[model samples]
Target chain A: MASHGLTYDGCNFFRQRLLLSTLSGKHVKIKNIRSRDDEPGLRDFEASFIRLLDKVTNGSRIEINQTGTTLFYQPGLLYGGSIEHDCNPQRSVGYYLEALLMLAPFMKTPLKATLRGVTNDPTDPTVDLLKSTSLPLMKKFGIDGEAFELKVVKRGMAPGGGGEVVFTCPVRKTIRPVQLTEPGKIKRIRGVAYSVRVSPQMGNRIVESARSVLNQFLPDIYIYTDHMKGVNSGKSPGFGLTLVAETLNGCFLSAEMSSTPQGQGDPVLPEDLGRNCAKLLLEEVYRGGCVDSSNQSLALLLMTLGQQDVSKVLLGPLSPYTIEFLRHIRDFFQVMFKIEVQKPLEDERKGGDKVLMTCVGVGYSNLSKTIK
Target chain B: HSERESDEEEEQGALKWKEGLQQKAAEAFLRQQAAAPNLRKLVYGSVVEAQESEEEEEELGGLFRVSRPQQSKKVQANTLDCSRFHPDTFHNWDVEEMLDSIRDCFVTGKWEEGHDAA
Candidate 1:
C-alpha cells in the first residue's frame, strides 16, 4: 500500500477523493479548490460533509487553510456506531448518505446514522431512490440482514430543508464477489410519488401521470402516493416521483425527478414532473444494465473490495461520474478493469450498447471487524 | 479478328477494379470495427490526463496574475460532485421510435424462445 499522500486539484469529485483516501488509509492533500473564482473557498455543504466524515472516523486529521481553498485529510479507523449529523441543505441527505453507504459496511461496529436535511432534491439521488435501488444492489454483494436498512423518518425539500432519515448497516468482514451479467426482463415497475407541505392531491396526480406513461409497456406497475403533513413534512412544499424497474434476475434500474426547489427555479406541475420522471425511467431502461446508472460506481467499488475473485457486472454506458470514479479507483486501489462492449443482437430491441466490466478484487478485508 | 481481340482486352482492363470490390469493402469494415469501440482507451485515455496538466497561468507586470475565466474543462473540474446521471437530451422520449427502442425490456414485450412469462 502506498502511504504517501495523494495530491489533487480543484473540488470536483471531492467526496470520491476523500472517500477513497479513507478506505485506502492514505493521506490526501487537495488544493486550488475554486481558487480563481470569486468568493473562493469551500462551500457550506462541503464543510458539512467534512464534519460528517469526522464524526464517522476516529483520530482523523483534517486541516483547511484560512481561505478553505486547500484541504488536507489523514483518515483514521472507521468507528461506525450510532451518529447524528445535520447535513447542509444546499445538497440533499442523499449526498451524505451515498458516502455513508460505502463506508458503513467496513466499520468497526454496526452503523446507525440519523441524517437530517433535504431528503428529496433535484441535484442528487433522493432518499427514496437510494432506499429502493441502492440497498438491493448492496444485498447482491452480501451486505444484508434484518438490520441493514434505510428509513426516511421525515420528508423535506430543498432550500429550507427539514427532513430526516435513519440508515443502518451491518459490518462485513469481506465483501462477496458477484457475477451480475444478466439483467432479466423487467417484471414490474414500482414507484413512490411523495409530496410534502403541499396538497395531497399532488402525490395522486404524480402517480396518475407516471402510470399513464408506464402502462404503455407493463401492466404490473404500482405507484404508491405518499403525502406527509404537519411535522413529518419538511419546511418546503414540493412533490417528486421515484420509479424502479425490477428485472427477474434481481437487478434494478431506477429513475426519479424532484420538483424544482421552492424559490430556486420555475415551479413545476405535478403532472409534468410525473411524466418527465416516467420518461426518464424509459431512458434508463434504454441504457439497460444489471445496475442502474446511479449505483454503477457503488457496484464497482464493491467489486474492487471483494475477496480476490473475479467479479463481473454488465453496465450501460458509463456516466461521467462513474468514469472519474474509475480513474480514482486506479489511483487509490491500483485496480484496472477489463472493459468489453457488448452490442445487442440485431433482432433484439433491448436499447443501446452495454459494457461488461471485469476485474479481480484486491481482497480487502475489514481488519477492524472483531471476530465473533 | 485482331480488332475484336483488342476490344476484348480493353473491356477487361476497364472492368478490372470491380474484381476485388467486396473484399476491399470487407477489409475496410473490419478496420473500422477494430478502431471504433476501444472502451479501455476511451475510459483511461490521454484526453482526461491532459486536463491535469493544462494549468497555465498568465502574469501581469510580474506581480499580479491574470485570472481568465475558466474553459469548459476547467469548469468541469470545479463543478458540483453529484452522482445522478442525467438522461441524454438527444433522446426525445415522446417519439414513438424512441419508446420502441426499449420495448423488449419489459415482460409484456417479446421473450426469447426458452423463457416464458411463467
Candidate 2:
C-alpha cells in the first residue's frame, strides 16, 4: 500500500473520498469545506460520520483546522464488530449506512450495527430503498449469507428522528466479479406505505393511489400498508412510500417519497405522494439497468474490488455522484473503466440509452478476516 | 430528411456517383458523431472544467466580493449529501405513448426469442 496521500477540495463527495481512502488504505486531505459559507466548516452530520468511522477502525488519524475548513485523514484497519451509533439527525441513518456497507465485508469480523436516527427522509436514499435494492445488488457479487440483512426496528421520519435499524453483514475474503448485462423483466412491483404518528388510513390511501398507477403495467403489484403507533412511531408525524420492482433475474430497482418533514414546508397529501412515487418507479424502469441510480457507486465499488476479473454492468446514464465515484476509483486504485453507450433500437419499447461499464478489478482481498 | 435531400441531389446530377459521395458519407458520419453522447468524456473529462467555474469569484470595489448565491453548481458541491437521482425531465405517465416507452420492461410485455415468460 502506498503511504503517500491524495488531496481534494470542497466537502462535496465527502463520504466517497473517505470511504475509498479507508478501503484503499490511502491517506486523504480535503480543503475548503464550505470555506465561504456563513458558518464555514464541516457540518454536524459530517462530524458524526467521522466519529462513526473512528469507532470502526483502529489507529486512524484525523485532523481538522480550527475553522474546520480543512480535513486530513489517515485511514486505519477496518475493525468491524458489533457496534452501536446514534447517527446525527441532520441526515438520515441511510447516509452513514451507505459508507458502512462499503467497508463491512472487508472488516476483521462480521459487522452487526445498531443505527439510531431517521429511517425515512426525502433528502437521502431511505433505509427501505437500500434494503430492497442495494442488498440484492451486493448479493450478486457473492456477499450474501445467513448474516446478510437490514431490519428496521422502529419507524422514524425526519427532523425529529427516533427510529432504530439493525444491519448485519458476513465478512468476505474476496468479492466476486459479475457480468450483469441483462436486468430481465420486472415480474412484480412490491412496496411499503408507512405512516408514523399519522392516520393509519394514510398508509391505505397511499397504497390505493400507487396501485392505480402501477396496476396498468403488471398484475403482480402488492404494496403493504404499515402504520406504526405509540413508541414505535418516531417523534414526528409523517408518511412515505417505498416501491421496489423485482425483476426475474433478482434485480431490484426502487423509488420512494416522504411527506415534508414537520414544519419544513407545505405538507403533501398521501394520495399525491403515492402517485408521484409510482411515477418515479416508472422513471426508474425507463432508466433500465441491472443496478438503479443510487446504488450505481456501490456496484462500481464491488466491481473494482473483485478478484482480478473483467466485470461488466449495464447501467443508466451516469448520475453526477456515480461519475465522481468513477473518477475517485481511478485516483485510488489506478483503474479506469471502458464505457460504451447502447442505444435502444428504433422499434424497441425499452426506455433510454444504457451505458455498459467494463473494468478489470484490483484483486483486493480481505487480509483482516480471521480464519476460525 | 437529410437522406431525402441527398436523394434529390443524386437525381439532379448527371452522374450520381461523382456527386460528392465522399462528402455525403463524411457529413453522415459527423451527424452520427453529434447524435451520440460520449459517456466516458462526460464522466471524467467534463468534471475538471466544472470545478474551474468555482474559481471565478468576482471582487467588488476592493472592499467586498460579489456572491452569486444562486449559482447552483457551486452550492451543489456543499449541498446535502444524497444519492437520489432526481430526473431531469419527467414523462407524464398519463400519456399512452410515454407509458408504452417502458412497457417492454415488464414480464407481460415483449420478450426476446430465446427467453420465455416461464
Candidate 3:
C-alpha cells in the first residue's frame, strides 16, 4: 500500500489553521497519545492526538476530563480524545490572561480557541493515522517569535500590550525566529535512591502536619517518614497553593509547599540539585518502592535533569540582565522550597555551556502562606 | 452576552479539566496515599496538563505543550507570582565544616577528587 496522499495536505491544513489561531491569539492543547486511566477507580479512558497528522483514534478508551468524562469506544479497539482550549485557571492563568491581553486588540470580539491534543507516538498512535517522528508537530512548536517571544514577563498591559502581541506571535511566518520549548534532560548519577513521604493519615498524631504532607513525586513516590506539619495548618482552606503532579505512567506525584506566616522553612542544602533530581524516579507509588521497570504499568511524572557544575556556567559569564533573571529563579527556589539548585547538565545552551537549572527537594507538602 | 456565555462555557470547560484533575488527584492520593511525610500530591494522580508554556527556548508555537514542571514553580508561573527560598533558613547545618572542606578541596585544586572520596 502506497501512501494515502493525505499527509501533506493534512499537515498543511493543520499548520495553516494552527498558525492562523496563533495569529488570532489561541493555541492547540495536545494530550498524551499513550496515557490510560487504569487505577481501580478512575473512569478508565484514554485517547490522544498525533501532532503531525489530523486524525482521531477510535474505539480505544481515552481518558478525557471533558464534562466529567466516561468511556465511548468505537466499533474496534480504537481510541480517541477531545480537543479544546485548556481552561485550567489556577494552573494556567498565565496563558489565558496573556491571550486576553495580547489578542484583545486583534479581536473586535472575544477570541475563541480551537484546541486539539497532538500525539507524536507511533508505536502506539493516539490516533489511527500518521508516522512517528512527526516533524510537522515539531515545526509547529519550533516556529519562534524572538527575545520576548519566548519569555514570561509583564509589561503593565496598557502601554506594553502591543509589544506583547508582537512577542507572542511574531510575523506568523513558517520558520521560527527562535525555538519555544521545554524538554527535560534526565540523566542518571550515583546516589542511594531512597523514598520519602508527606502525609497526615491520623488526626493529632498529626494535625495539619506539614511534615506529613510534603510529598515528592520525582525520583519516585517514596512517601517520606518525616512527619512535621502544624496541627491545624496542613489541610486548611485559605492556602494560596495546591500541588498537582504526575509521572510518566501518569501517576501524579505531588505535595504543597508551606511556611508559617512570616517564617523561614527547614533549610535543606541539596547534595547536588542536578544529581538529586536526576535520581528522583522509577517506582515507589504503587508498591511504594522501586519501580521494577518490567513489572510496572503506565509510567507518569517524568523528571529529567542531570548532575553538572553550575559554577563555570551560571556564575561565569552572561549579559547582566539574563544572568540576573536566571539567578533570581534559582535563589528564589532555594528559599521557597528549602532545597538546592544547580545548573542543569543536559539541555545546555548550544554555543555556550550554560545548560538548564534544576531545583531538588525531598517529599511533598502544602506550604502555601494562608489561613483557614 | 454570547461572549459571556462562551466565557462561561470556556470556564466550565477548564473547570472540567480541573474537576477531572481533582478526581484524579483524589485517586492519586489514595494510590500513593503513602506519600512522604512532607510531599503529597495536593491534587493526587499525575495530571499532565496540556498548556502553552514557553519555558523551553527550543520548542515551537501555536499550541499547548505538556511537561511536568516543578509543581511549585508551575503554580507560581500560572499565577504570575514570584517564589522564594531562604538561604538563612535553608537546610544543611554544618556550613563551616562543609565550607572548610570545600576550601581545602579548592586549594588542593582537586575538588572532584575530594568530592568523590567524601
Top candidate by lDDT: 1
Q: Which regions of candidate 3 are displaced past 4 Å?
A: A1-67, A70-88, A94-147, A150-167, A171-372, B1-118
Docking class of 3: incorrect
lDDT of 1 by residue, A1-372 (tens): 457989988999999999999999989999999998898989999999999999999999999999999999999999999999999999999999999999999999999999999999999999999999999999999999999999999999997889999999999999999999999999999999999888898999999899999999999999999988899998998989999999999999999999999888799999999998998899899999999999999999999999999999999999988988998998899899999999999989899999999999999999998778
lDDT of 1 at A309: 100
Report the candidate with higher TM-score, 2 versus 3: 2
True contacts kept of each: 0.86, 0.84, 0.00
Any residue pairs clashing in model 2, and if so which?
none
Candidate order, lDDT descending: 1, 2, 3
Per-residue alpha-carbon lDDT of candidate 3 for residues A179-225, written as tens digits (9 for 90 to 100): 11221111111111111122323211221222122221123222222
> lDDT values of the candidates?
0.91, 0.91, 0.22
Q: Show the lowest summed lDDT stretch of 10 residues, model 2 chain A.
A: A316-325
lDDT of 1 at A92: 96
List where candidate 2 sits over 4 angstroms from the true fold: B1-35, B46-75
Candidate with best DockQ: 1
lDDT of 2: 0.91
Better of 2 and 3 by DockQ: 2
- iRMS values in order, in angstroms? 1.0, 1.3, 19.3
* Steric overlap count per candidate: 0, 0, 118
